[model samples]
Target: MGLIDHLKARLGPARGKVSDLAQQHGDKVQHGLDKAAKAVDEKTKGKYSNRIHTGTDKAKGAMDRLAHKDEPGTEGGGGSGGGDMFTPPRTPPPTS
Candidate 1:
């Protein structure tokens, strides 16, 4: 197998564990993220507070997605179910 495949094979279990933990403690994770952002914002004197908040929000969103990856109807593309990791999300065509 290629290097990427070998690495994925080794890390698959770790990724699954992370997903399970994300699902189990998602609220706590989000809370911790908010607390950290608040601490950093205070330390920075609100200079980068907006950016920090944005990043924190994105991180939380990503965590939520990972936590819900196996739930029905949670796919980014609204997929039916069950596919490999590389399935492409369907996109709508642009209006003229």
Candidate 2:
């Protein structure tokens, strides 16, 4: 197997453990994120309020996905379910 595949195989169990922990403590994790976001916003005097909120929301979404919150058998069920890592959206090339 390739290096990437071998690394993935080694880390699969760790990933599963992390997912289980995320599932169990998702609420707490989200709350902490909100708290941190609020602190940063306050520190910046709301200068980046919108961006801060957007980042916080993205973090929460990531946590939810990690917990498999949208998948069947978990709370808030009903999703095709994805266990893949986060893939950022690509940007279009700028016109000259």
Candidate 3:
């Protein structure tokens, strides 16, 4: 098997376990993220407040997806995948 395939196969079980743990401790994880963000912002004197909030939101979104919280027919389902992370932002056309 290819390296990527082998890695996926080996990590499959671990993924499920992590999903379960995420589901169980998601709130705690989110709380900790918020706390850390606050601490960082304080240390930086709010210089990176916007970036810190954005990063924290992205992290929480990832955790939710890892927990399958957006899967339909499941508890707490119906949330989106927080959009495509790889998609580039659209820019307005330049005026002539």
Could you estimate the TM-score for every candidate?
0.73, 0.73, 0.74
lDDT of 3 by residue, 1-94 (tens): 5999999999988888899999899999999999999999999999989879878987887887877743565445345545634436546556
Q: Give the distance in Å from residue 88's predicted Cα in candidate 2 to where it truly belongs.
A: 7.0
List candidate 3 segments past 4 Å from native: 69-96
Tell how far residue 41 is off in model 1, in angstroms: 1.0
Clashing pairs in 3: none
Report the lDDT tens digits of candidate 1 across residue range 13-41: 99889989999999999999999999999
Looking at candidate 2, what is the lDDT of residue 68? 84
Which ten contiguous residues of candidate 1 have the minimum total lDDT? 79-88
CA shift of 95, model 1, Å:
35
Q: How does candidate 1 score on lDDT?
A: 0.78
Candidate 1, residue 26: Cα displacement in angstroms equals 1.0
Off by over 4 Å in 2: 73-96
Rank order (by TM-score, best first): 3, 2, 1
